[model samples]
Target: MSSGSPLLADLIEALRCLPGVGGKSAQRMAFHLLERERERGLKLADTLHEAMQRIGHCTRCRNFSEEPMCTICSNASRDRHLLCVVESPVDLAAIEQATGYRGQYFVLMGRLSPLDGLGPQELGLDLLSERLGEGEIEEMILATNPTVEGEATAHYLAQLARAAGIKPTRLAHGVPLGGELEYVDRGTLAHAFGSRLSVD
Candidate 1:
């Protein structure tokens, strides 16, 4: 439903570029911005433009940063001997917020999906190998998601860590912390059962 105004239609179309934003949602957002949040919308547009121009990947960890080195990489107090391998910056943020891990990180950016044209080279394995050769990291944590492609990527990372003489560890996969076994999915239940640990 084009509102007969090309500028309004263009705004809605532009909003559709955001992930999960369909035509209807984009139209709603565009209407909201025009109706009551014009000032805030302008601020958001300015900030988005600035961020797009200024944000670049950290040379060391591949995380988004405005500087050459991100804050985590520049922090001297963080453990240099522990490097966590994650599939995305969001995963890194989640780990940072959820756990007390104060280690360096290597973001893969994407997993190993051959069909999608994402491979080791795309994920910057060469850079990761170079970092691994530096000999500072004692352990490499494989924190990729539990999906098929993620598991494949994690296996490859584990092999890379082993070749570099660093211990490789994986994030435990199974049922949620406070969930009952009967309610858990079949795959999750089976995995948890197979990887069960002995209670102390």
Candidate 2:
């Protein structure tokens, strides 16, 4: 549905480019910006333009950065021998926030989904291989999500780590803490049961 103004319609269409923003959501955003938040909208536009122009992928970890290297990659205090592999930058942020992990990271950017045209090349496996071969990393943490594609990607990465003589470890998957087994889903419950640890 087009509004009387072509510019307003264009703005709504442009807003629809954001993830999870549909036609109605975009239209509401467009109207809100135009009617009440024009100054903030202009500021956002300027900031977005600047960020788009300045931010580029870090040469080391492939994370978004204003320079060739990201802060995490360049930090001297982080453990260089521990490399955590994640599917996306968002996952990396989550791990950083939730855990006291002080290790280097390698962002896959996307998992191996041949149907979606994301493969080893697109995920920068060559770069990862080169980094592994450097002999600096002692352990490779496979922190990819527990999805089908993520499992495949983690397996591939584990093989790569083994080939490079680096130890590969996967994140523990199971029922959440403080959750009862009856309330947990069957898949998660089964996984937790099968992978149970013995009490000392």
Candidate 3:
């Protein structure tokens, strides 16, 4: 029932492309923004532009960061010998939310999907190998999702870990099949981290 202003229609289309937001939600958001104070809306746009311009993958773990290394990597209190390997930056953030881990992280950014033409190099497995070869990492905990591709990626990393003489483990119970870590509860995530099982 909107009057179909071109600017509003374009904004609605752009907002609809965001994940989990359907046509109604997108239109509502567009209308809300259009009704907001101009300076407030412009500030939001500037914030998005600044984040997109400054945020890049961390050089070591591939997590999103504003600098060469992520805040976790730069923290000296984190366990340098223990590294948690996750499928994406979101996975890493999920695990961190549990607030029990004191280890570092390596983000794969994706899982191994042969049907989708994704492989080791595509997920930065080479960079992982290099990190493992550095001899600083003694243990790696795979925190990939419980889907087929996630399982395959974890096993693949296990093989690489064994070849490099590093202990490899997978997240324990509480994470359901095909369920992403981001959606799991904090207590379950903490328990999973506490009960990690060796993959050797």
Cα-based TM-score, every candidate: 0.91, 0.90, 0.81
Instruction: Write the residue-wise lDDT of candidate 1 on 86-187 in tens digits.
Output: 999999999999999999999999999999999889999999999999999999999999999999999999999999999999998899989988899999
Choose 1 or 3, whichever is better by TM-score.
Answer: 1
Q: How does residue 59 of candidate 3 score in lDDT?
A: 92
Candidate 3 lDDT, tens digit per residue, 1-200?
36658878777888876899988998888778778767787898899889989999999889999999989999999999999999888888789897599999999888999788888888998899999999999999989998878988899999999999999998766777788999998877897789788999
* Model 2 misplacement above 4 A: 1-4
Q: Which ten residues in a row have the lowest lDDT in candidate 2?
A: 1-10
> What order do candidates take by lDDT, descending?
2, 1, 3
Model 1 gets an lDDT of 0.95
Residue 70 alpha-carbon offset, candidate 1, angstroms: 1.6
Between 1 and 2, whose lDDT is larger? 2
> RMSD to native for every prediction?
1.7, 1.9, 6.4
Clashing pairs in 3: none
User: On a 0 to 100 scale, what is the lDDT of residue 104 in model 1?
Assistant: 96
Summing lDDT over every window of 10 consecutive residues in candidate 3, give the lowest-scoring window. 1-10
What lDDT does candidate 3 reach at residue 81?
97
**Among all candidates shown, the one with the greatest TM-score:** 1
Q: Model 3 off-target regions past 4 Å? A: 1-4, 37-39, 174-200
